[model samples]
Target: MSVTISFNNVIKKYNDKPVISGLSLDIKKGEFFTLLGPSGCGKTTLLRMVAGFNSIEGGEITFDDKVMNRITPQHRNIGMVFQNYAIFPNLSVKNNVAFGLKNRKIPKDEIERRVDHILDVVQISQFKNSMPENLSGGQQQRIALARAIVMEPNVLLMDEPLSNLDAKLRVDMREAIKLIQHEVGITTVYVTHDQEEAMAVSDRIAVMNSGVIQQVGTPREIYQRPANIFVSNFIGRTNIVERSLKKVDNRQVLIMDENYQIDLDDITQYAEEIIKVSIRPEEFTISDTSEGMAGVIQHNVFLGINVHYTVQLSNGENVEVTEESTLGEPLEPGTEVKLLVNKEKINLFHYESEKNILEGDSYAK
Candidate 1:
């Protein structure tokens, strides 16, 4: 059965230097949760803690309301898929998948039945007798997954399982993993440094940095409304530009530059003179008339589905804007354009704390 995982004020350290500090998260049963960040950001460290490979320095980790901090890896009943595709070189796919059951002295017929079922579920039954050396990278990963799930552990932990595959194979494998996880209904904690991969597969993601979680939300929420400047800049392409907010009489007015201004409606809490705002590339639209900020196109590239443009503003700052390629003809480099920014979608972050000032709930905190 699937189990809920919880981290209650968890802490980890190396030589008194805190790697993970006071982390708290609740992963629902049958949820595909991901820990995503750059290298040395402590995502792997947290995953190891759950696997019982690393000891928690402080706080507690629980499985279905049962504390698991003191449980050994072997006794925890957690299955792990690693980055290296840890399959024996000489063992056939079927044998590799049945190794765990054999070690546990399960009945011979039971091992055979479980192995065959899992091989078919992973769509690698055709290669059941093939050695690991004869399989492709993607196929080998499938074998590893089959081996892990055949034991029917309470939790499944995958550490960068697709990192070794080619780009196309990575995409295909992630889709396959997503499908298999749904069918099996296992509570999974996936670790990855790729944002696109995390966004594609996770029900909810915890973006990490320096051993701390930066934000936790669904993929759309993290992409559209980031909790801080670090999250905005890390998840996708965003143009972070400096803007000024002024109290014009009673209402707050945002000055993009001397050329463009927006009147805030109910957002009266912002009183800072200068604020940093994150505007996504796809948030801007080209206008026929001078309705908004005016800029000159510096460069344009055709990306088949979308046309990417770099616009130089009056302040000499470059802003990126992407539009549907089928909208109209692509703008040339030297062309002048009026760009309209979507006011409602723009995110304002405090200059000092770097926390999002526009949103009421702060995920980082």
Candidate 2:
């Protein structure tokens, strides 16, 4: 049975410092959701609250409309997988997976059936008799997952469960976890600092910073249309250039930079001051002739599939452009090049503030 989870004005504190403040979220049943942010951003704390490991100081948490504020961890009907795997070293894989059922005093035959089933589901049946120390990192993690999910909890909470694995193993484990969640249709809440992992696996992502949710959306929504400057900067790389806006007509404004003048329409309702124009690295083309801005290549990094060029504009500002490797010969440092910024792909944000010059229209269309 899957369950919907909700948080209403949730707050947490440690040493009088607010770790999570006024957080409210609704997680749908059987959805794979990820809490993504930098370290010390309160994602782990929020997960712990849901697991009944930490106390909520304000608001309430509900699972399937039942207030879970006072529920004990054992009674919450939730499974958890941690970063360290946490398997008993002395026990064989089969025994570790059956430990929870053993504690519950389940019938020996039923425990054996469930353990065998989960081991097969996690594709570790062949290693059932092996000790945890004998398994690879990925194998150990699968065992941990099997142990948790065999309990058939309504919700699953994972905290940096892949952090200890190698890069290649982390990728494989994420795919495996997603596949398993889909097969079981469990409501899952995952916490991680890796933006790529969150983007790759989650049905939706909640971006948090300093105890607040900056934005929550589908991976494409968050990447293509950020809610604010912080969201824009944090989710991916962008070239932010300062610009001043001059009224051109009733519905148009001319943006002035050091060497370029571009027209923009439909100003945001909250946009009164023009600050910076944000262009993604892939939104520009490199050419020999100047469209408006002229710059000299400062650095060129060849990253196998795509080449990155850092150019210093005439105004002494740095702009980065990513181009396909097959376009031309590699650009060398000190080479002069003109960059054409895509007008349709440009995003303007208020200077150092949450107010967007394009309002929410950036994400709407």
**Which candidate ranks first by TM-score, i.e. highest?**
1
lDDT of 2: 0.87
Q: What are the clashing pairs of model 1? A: none
lDDT of 2 by residue, 1-365 (tens): 79999999998989878888889999999999999999999999999999999998999999989999999989999999999989999999999999999999999999999999999899999999999998899999999999999999999999999999999999999999999989888999999999889998899999999989999999988887777777788888998777776654444554545566766655635333557777889988886565657888999998888999998988898988999998877899999888877766677777777445664444444
In candidate 2, residue 339 scores what lDDT? 82
Give the clash count for each candidate.
0, 0
Which residue runs does candidate 2 get wrong by more than 4 Å? 254-259, 265-272, 359-365
- In model 2, the worst 10-residue window by lDDT is 265-274
> What TM-score does prediction 2 earn?
0.93
For candidate 2, give the lDDT of residue 129: 97
lDDT of 1 by residue, 1-365 (tens): 79999999999999998999999999999999999999999999999999999989999999999999999999999999999988999899999999999999999999999999999999999999999998899999999999999999999999999999999999999999999999999999999999999999999999999988999999988987899999999998999998999898887888987778888664668875799989999989888887878899999999999999999987788999999999988999989888888887788888889988774433243
